[model samples]
Target: MGRKKKKFILGIDLGGTKILMGLFDRKFGLKKTVKLEMDGNRGEKFFFNKLIDGIEEVLEETGSDLSDLVTIGIGCPGIIDIYTGTVKVSSNVSFFKNYPLAEKLKAKLRVPVFIENDANAALFGEQQFGAARGHGEVVGVFLGTGIGGALIINGHLYRGVSGGAGEIGQTFLSIPSVSDFETTRLKVGALVGRNAIASEAGFLLLRQKCPHLLEEIGYNVKKIRSGALSRAIRAGDTALEDLIRSRSRWLGVALANVVNVLNPELVLLGGGMMEAMGKIILPEVRSGIEACALKPLMKALKVVPSRLKDNAVILGASKMACEILKMTQK
Candidate 1:
């Protein structure tokens, strides 16, 4: 009898500071993974070259070639045109305006390519195999350096018209007493993002003349990352804990809006921020939702932390590649 040929998929996740490429089997289990730092300031060519190099490294490490892969899928952090595979605009990576990413990759690698918004890809991953498994309607909200969101409806990703529907971070709300003169509106991203946490903590520490947080992190505000903040909270930094709690309340408010509208069965949270502080933030988020969201919607909703963590987007992309390959085969 002839040996059964191996079928695999390649998945890439492009984020603000890093790129992850993985080789996956038919079941979306990772065979090999490669990580690369992304320097968005280095221009598009340099970044694209790094992506190609990472893909090649993973394939070589796994003893697989491009021919062994059915398709390649990329989860990009931007407004993506799924039909054209073009990145319209990326807030973190500014150089990717109207970039035909899939076409470029397909040309270089000679394989079918699929592109999707990174959050959407993560949601798809959860739906296929992670937290949202067995749920038809789901909402995924990832808290990291920035907040990102995605919607799943009736077993399919819901990228609304113009492919930019699930941008929950961009939700706006009025802020009171910014300078004691006038109210101001700000995006939820600015209020709850990791960088925002750092900035707000720094400002509060300096304003209130508290040095405990500075002492904990050796006086380096830049070191106030998600993990660092988690450690500080564990060590009884009341000021920092309060700050995180307030921000988490806002996160809950944002999520409540989503829940009230979509009323999905599940709200899966992922990303570094959630991984570090989900335990502290989730209950507060639930409280905020319960306070604001409609009773019926709130009753049916389940907010849970993602089990896949960092690999969610990559696996989701792999699943998407497999789906696209199936379509092509048909």
Candidate 2:
């Protein structure tokens, strides 16, 4: 008789707007996945309840309740304590403040629970199972509402003393400006959410150039995405090209700083805007890095697009769960 397939762990990627759950085997391959709305209400009560509902649904759908799973891993959009499994602060999801997330989930499910920052989890997931799979040292940069980065060193994640290392997007790029007094001030470039500027700028440019798109998409052009901007750029829209160019310049400079610091074997770019702006932005980013970076290290790294796409975080959470299980057993 063939050996039976083993039971798996559960991985949850809880973002600001969505909750994605997946069942993964020991090897971290996803057996099944389920997505549910975040239902961003007021406080912890509503958020936890919504999470409970989603977990129950996934367990039911897979016919594998919490008792059968080895452990659970969660990725939340905030500052987290990987050692204590606590959520410290959250920008987009406010209810996560000081929440004992791992304890609460453990009590409900009666299983070991691990928590990590969503960005770190996503980076780990991509390195283990997605874009940076083959490399020993890798940096994963996620550009969306904000920039998030994860670094893998010697095939293991390098979580700094505070477990908050690799926040590359927060790296500042100073642009020199001269005032009437001849004193110079530096204007920081694009520190806001990458998606925010892309969507907003893309909408404005589209409104000026492609009013027909507004008519076709019901003028809900505010809902425009980075891919749509790329399509417009390819279609020879001058405004769209210019908008991408501007974002690319800012993003390139910021990433160049990150490259100079980490000097990882590879840099994997993921998130909403990367797909649209990657091709146009990476060359310029490389140029900026070469212009500014240390000569020897500048030629060593390669930046590329993510292979797993949107599924990176979910898979990473699952991989984390598997790792936690290994630790517990030892």
The candidate maximizing TM-score is 1
lDDT of 2 by residue, 294-318 (tens): 7777678887888877777877877
CA lDDT, every prediction?
Answer: 0.84, 0.71
Q: Clashing residue pairs in candidate 1, if any?
A: none
Q: Which residue runs of candidate 2 sit more than 4 Å off their true CA positions?
A: 1-6, 39-41, 175-192, 202-207, 210-213, 216-222, 227-237, 275-281
Q: For candidate 1, lDDT tens digit of each residue in 1-330? A: 975475888888888778988889877778888999877778888987888889889988988888888789999887999878899988877788998988988999898999999999998998888888999998888887788989988888999888888888887656555653333237788788888898888886677543566667765777778888888778777788888888888888888888888888888889888899988888888887888899988778888999888899999988887787788789
* Per-residue lDDT of 120 in model 2: 86
Q: What is the lDDT of residue 108 in candidate 1?
A: 90
